[model samples]
Target chain A: MHSPHFSVIFSLDALTGALFLLTAIGVVATRQVLASLQLFIAQSLLLSLSALLLGIALGSPHLFAVAGITIATKTVLIPWLLRHTVSVEVYRTREIDRVLNIPSSLLIAAFLVVIAYAIANPLLGAVDLPFARINLPLGLAAMFLGVFTVVARREAVPQLLGLLALENGVFFAGVAIVPELPVIAELAAAVDVPVVALVVGLLTRQIHKRIGSTSVGRLAALRER
Target chain B: MELAAILLIPALASGFALLPTNRHFAAPMTVAATVVVFILASAVAVRTTHTGRVDALGQWLTCDGLGALILALVALVAMTAALFSWGYIRIRAGHSERRKEQHYYALYNLFVMSLLAVPILANVALMWVAIELTTLLSAFLVGFEDTPEALEAAWKYVVLTTLGAVLALLGFLILYWGSQVAGYAPFTWAGLVEAAPRMPPALLWPAFLLILVGFGTKVGLVPMHTWLPDAHSQAPASICALLSGVETTTVLYVILRLFPVVGGTPSLDARPWFVGFGLLSVAIATLLLIYVRDFKRMFAFSTVEHMGIILVAAGLGGAEAHLGAAYQMAGHAIAKSFCFFAAGAVATVFGTQEIAAIRGLVRFAPLTAVALTAGAFAITGAPPFAVFISEFLIFKAGIASGQYLTIALLATFVVIAFCAVMFHINRMTFSTPLGSVPATALPLSCSATLAVAAIPLVVIGIYVPPALQDLLHAAATAMGG
Candidate 1:
């Protein structure tokens, strides 16, 4: 009996997409700076995995290229850049400061997820792509979570992770809708994301050196009277 | 070839500046490179004025009417800001910090190169990359002073704008998806326009909203503008000129480029969104202008005000309002850059940016006083300045279009912003000097920059050259006028 490749890929891709959204939530919920970074790495890997499966299902070589670029840049180059740019201590930091407590942040995060799916529902109904049924809402939900994480987190490293997760969410949605324009995804992963990490990481080191802490949300020296 | 050369020159200059060289080498090298870029960009603007397009690599690197206008403004600001930086950087760093100054020039050239490439790059994806690079390359420049506050501002600037860029990236990818569904096409603005009508409104609306709100953040629209005042106020004045002057406009150009595409699609209207966000930004900036104590921060908020006016003009519709929008973009760029230079000069002279601290500049520092008052007059829509002409045209266009409520709100905000700006400048100009402040002489290069930047600010208000008027016409028509 021939295997049902369509259902197989759909279920497998749905699984990967769920894991991807989970990692995005993990970033928002985690209190440790190191845990958020790990969650971001896991999220990036899930993104590349989804890209790989979407490439096979869509039969697009362009998405395969995007997958490779995501792994090479996001999981590998970004972490390496962060390691050298920011000190070792920032990664070792356990008590990552955040603007809101975990339950409150997660509550708002849950609200954001519902709103995201509501926003994506109209969009998905307007199009008839099968894979979009899984990716669009999940990716949008993850993006909402990522934005929440950025708003809630107080430290530089966690905040940067939240921003990265936001990007990963976009790309996760992107693979289903724009497998043809792999150039944008590739350029974003290889050129844009790593630079964001390197620059923000370097800035974090400078702030730590000058301000004696990486809790950038605590920075209030530049306010108006 | 010219477009290619324009991008090439600054990339080369950035490399040259990083070479282990004397303190004197970097600034001049950067200035010469921007001069070449300015001349080449002006040629492109002139050619586009006559022929309406210039293509370097078929579709990937091309310039249309609006692109040429933005290119010219960015290049002009870069050249003048480079010249200003020559003396400003030297005075700020003294003889001891040669390495830091060299690094500053290197970053400055790369930053300008990215700004220059934004208009010229035809591929939307690559253009986003260039915009992202503008932030990364300039982060260090924004924090160049090494103060805790400067670093904080830079930290916020990079993180926030990069986040905005990512959100816009998703929007762009969605737009690409829309194009693919309508019919496979290249992912350029022109290609999107061709595909817009057939594209699903479902996809079009989300892409438009995402990009508008996303890049709207970088454009420093009201609610998304918290990072702007800090970054613009903290950066070195020369960098502030580029940041406040063209960087915001350059990104806004990306959002504006979509007007035609969105306008082309059925069941989609971008004007209400534009007018709503535009008027809100203007209103908020006016209120903030009243209480702004730091002169640099005041100029930064004024920038927020001008961006809103341009958005309103764009939303007001018709060729006249669109032309006014184009004029306002040009006028704001020149006047805003000059205002920062005036602020820089005041900072240099009295060693303070607080509006309350410096007084009797007219008596104690006559040259500084003149520059400050003239800058205020030019930027606040006083007579015989580009901003005045542009705002008047915008209002006339708004009235013609019969959007009285929108026009009324905008007019009220502009007037209040005017009074707020003038009051602060007046106190700083003629009021008595507070506590015996010593007014140091402005550096020769900075003074020369003021004279040079003043030319267009003053001339364009009173007269618009025929070729430039044609250029503005082309730019407006390209905006769906």
Candidate 2:
């Protein structure tokens, strides 16, 4: 197999990494739940692209397998499961409110990106990959943003999307740093995600069915009366 | 051969649980599976005491001193939980009874399978996968009723624990990378511990803290333990036993496995973190216990309190403390399972979990009232019970090591928790009958399981069986005693 020059692969991967970060922001910033979820799909797609590029760049075949798993599980399977579980009526009734306003959240997210770069900077010199120093920080930044989204969003679906984004960030960092991470760990995690998605989706459906809304804040009534 | 048998039993049980059998078969099948597992697991525990370790498929599956002890505990509780499920499902409401029973049994087996996998697996990565699977499987069981409360509990459980697991995954990856840097390939627990001294402090310390925080969530450590009470309270009683008694310990098993590795690091101090988190958790859970109104939630908080006690013992870093921690684990598992079973029986009889509504249980269901009282006594570390012995050992170890302030604080909280636990159970069991109390027949399964659990609580209190004592001593050594 003919291999592309190092610079070309690196540029493409860097672009995908950039797009990955942008989609994570899109998820946190979007007002509509469906749009937020759709942005997660976009984030997963970029994650798969980055993984594919890293696989080709590093000459590691397992990253290709990881890329495939990412696409199949995160991109295709999870989105389909979620869309099927959520009714279209949910869209009209639910525009997810943020605990922090969007612009402020985005500002905090950008600050988190700076912290990520700082944390990633020192660790970069120790690893083997040269491109990892560039890609890993963005991955870390995305993770920070995703966690912010989980804590800042009140709805079940948006919070779920936030968790997915966090995972995508972790996966990107995993490939950048330790591409040979055991296939078993990756595969087991891949298989486990769909189960988590299915369970969480079913649970969301149950919450909506009984409570008529998936606002997690409204669940405060369970305490002793 | 025994290791293979131990793993295969649960795997096969999970498969059989999925079969399209009549609803009548679910309980019996589940009971049979758990019984077989208990027997095999006990045999393996005994053999590990004599044999020192059991390995199969090379290092893919291994049961060492610690693993055997934990595996035995898992089986013991799973058996009780399975039996408890028989009674729990019989009286449960608000669902298609047959389908719900079938699904409950199926998920119960799968959950047990993952719990089994946690201790027996040799590789850290595989162990993490197993622990993650336990959460994935049990979160559904937590929401099996599909009520709003159950769903809310399940959602919080999945999101919180899975987030914790992700951090743990990051920790494991870094450990794996560090292993490679140190020239170890497989990243098994043994390999990681061996290579830990050479691992750079930058990698070792962060990985250790990440794992502590990550698995700490699964262990239901404070701040991260918000999901525990809700999930445990909302779940069916039988499932609560496994989740509280077994799953928490199984995940904490990961942290314990990492302890020696972190100890092997040359420059990092690990004890303060354990002690800090342990003290924090105990403090929070103790305060919550005084105000807990829901009986199941009270027990759930007690589980948190017990986890803290065990962690404190481990953090003491004395040989006696490690042994005490092992004994605490066994005692807590038995006592907690018994309490949950009795509470389930009482809830079934009274049709409510509110402690206020449960006045004069003795007048209504005398046997469960007796079991509940005994369980509370045993769990609170009353004399002539297993927890008393373990807690005493911990106190002795703490004093010997000159942790006087921590011990004083521990004693204060223990007394408060004891009074609080006893107060609730006493009011529930012996309070005046507020109205016409029905004389409902307790389920045979509930009574039988509690009877079985009572033996260990009483026996281990007075005398630890020689075989079990051997296993506990060996386990203590495995943890660096």
Candidate 3:
């Protein structure tokens, strides 16, 4: 009976790890800005599930509240507002100008994963928490991968989505290490995320309307004297 | 009582000013509100000399030596800027509308309230929110004219700074996490300071860098200062005064508040980084200021340069340098605003911001021309001005620290910037008229505002009060020099 329980716990941990890995991959592999947005939403949902499972296993009620707020804001309201504000029809039809090809981006991401592991391995080696040692590298890798996505994408919408992905990676790392943030701080962070989304959404619309495209390259017009 | 008067009155008056009243009433109402706040802030500064501190709002806001000094500076600039706005907007209203004028006043009050809240807020997160609110509330004001260029500058200002602020948020999270690891309960300023020694240095180091760079963007430090020239040049003169004077200083105050938490860590030496960035900013800004085309842009670049000076002073990390930094903040607040006010009056008289297009300003408006010339001299650190005194002290401290190259470079760049500003001001004031002269002179109110702005620049230059010097020493000591 004890062996079965241990197996169940091990499977849940593996599932959580796989979800993080796939989200990082999806963020890199996708070329379409709209697809990137959708992938970011999926990544947030997966993060919510992982946080919820960790909360249940640890029996921390505050974690449950955080999980719920994360799912509600990240998975639903922010994406819905972003979709409407960004004009999906424009992003859907146009192809994103990738700074690096998909294969090269994926390779770079893999290298980043190795470096993250190299950095995180010794640090987490002494940690006593279950799965803490393994998840640390994954969390850091996801963060690097998210930043890579931001650097690779040409369009503003995807760049923003990339930022959100990076935030998600950081959140995962926070949970994996600390287990739970103070409720007030968590709420502040959660509220700040959507406010940022709203501002970015508004600016994206304005940029598209004025410049006819949301490419950051066009923003180079304003330069120093 | 003084704390409540400094903070709460403007917040209350903000709501009242937003009400539907005669459009002409808004400006005077805002001015009255500012005067009250200014008096209370002065009282607090005076009282705190003897009492040592003032607490209010259930201790959520307190005015210590550092906070009191900044509060007094903000109140001083805000009041004069408010008076200037009254005349500035009244003239603008003749071209625009009463309703639009009311909106400007409302946003103006909101901006002041936000700046007033920053130094007083006791919680770190609450302070961040207040600082972010300054950006949001001021965005509309920055683009108040609604020209395409104005709107574009505002958009860039908000987007880039907000992005930097997100990094700051991550920094705050890291600090909170570090505190948690050290077994602290809540993320308050008092709590963090008490728990600082025990917190892990690894976490605190990254958090410090992130917050410095993050807030440094708003402070107009090099590489992140792209928004300063555009926003300051585009906005009206009153708004420019607030932007260059109080707003940027308020953000720097946040970074200074965090110095104690991370500066004490043995492995993480932040001074070199601050000095390095400071020297770089000064070099770039001085070079850029030499070639800048617009007078407003020139003044804006000077802000970047002065901010760099303050950072270098603070980074020197000693009693004397920290005192210099405190004094520099107050001096720059007065000098930069006076420069902007003169620039605004020049823009009004000459009907242009382009350097080449404006000439013979002294021939046309003598009072404004003298103000502009005086402002240029003061800002460039010429003799008998507060900026010159503080900047000299900074260089003295830098030399004492054995940063010989930094001192030499700073002196060279400051001279370059000085030449650039003098070049423009001389051409505008002394050169023959290139365009048609204005039919009417500057209004009494406009001249009065400029005079009010210039007095502090001249006064602090001649003498530094013992009480004010004591306050400066206290603030420097509190910042962990």
DockQ of each: 0.76, 0.58, 0.24
Q: Which ranges in model 2 have alpha carbons more than 4 Å from their true place? A: A1-4, A91-93, A125-128, B93-96
Which candidate achieves the best lDDT against the true structure? 1
Q: Relative to the unseen true structure, what is the C-alpha lDDT of residue B152 in candidate 3, on a scale of 0 to 100?
A: 66
Native-vs-model 1 lDDT? 0.89
Clashing pairs in 2: none
Per-candidate TM equals 0.98, 0.96, 0.89
Candidate 3 CA-lDDT value: 0.79
| TM-score of model 3 (CA atoms) | 0.89
- How many angstroms is residue B292 displaced in model 2 relative to the true structure, after the best TM-score fit? 1.0
Question: What tens digits encode model 2's per-residue C-alpha lDDT throughout A1-225?
Answer: 326677898888888888888998888788788888889888888888888888888888999999899999988899888878866666555554558788898898889999989887666656556667767788788888888887788888888888888888888888877888888878888987787778778777878888888887557746634
Docking tier of model 2: it is medium
Can you give the lDDT of residue B265 in candidate 1?
A: 77
lDDT of 1 by residue, B443-479 (tens): 8889999999989888888999987898899999999
Q: For model 2, how big is the iRMS in angstroms? A: 1.9
List the global CA lDDT of all models: 0.89, 0.84, 0.79
Q: Write the residue-wise lDDT of candidate 2 on B1-481 in tens digits.
A: 6667766877777677667877668788888888888898888899888888888887689888889889999999998889877866776733456767777777888889889989988778788888888988888799887778888888888888988988787788778878877885667777888899887777777678889998999899998999899998999999998988888988877788777898897678787787888888999999999999999999999999989998888888878999999999999999988888888888888878898888888877888889999988988889989999999999999999999988898888988999999999999988898898665677788788888878887888999889999999988888877
lDDT by residue for model 3 (B1-481), tens: 5676676777777787778877768878888999999888878877667677778888777777888888888888888888888877777657458777877887788889889988887777777778877887788788777655666677667766765675676677667767777886556666777666777776777678878888988999999998888888988899999999889988998888787777656667888888888888888999898888888989999999988988888888887888889989988999998988898888877778888887787778888889999999998999999888888988898889887888898889888889988998899789988657653556566788998877788888998888787777777877778
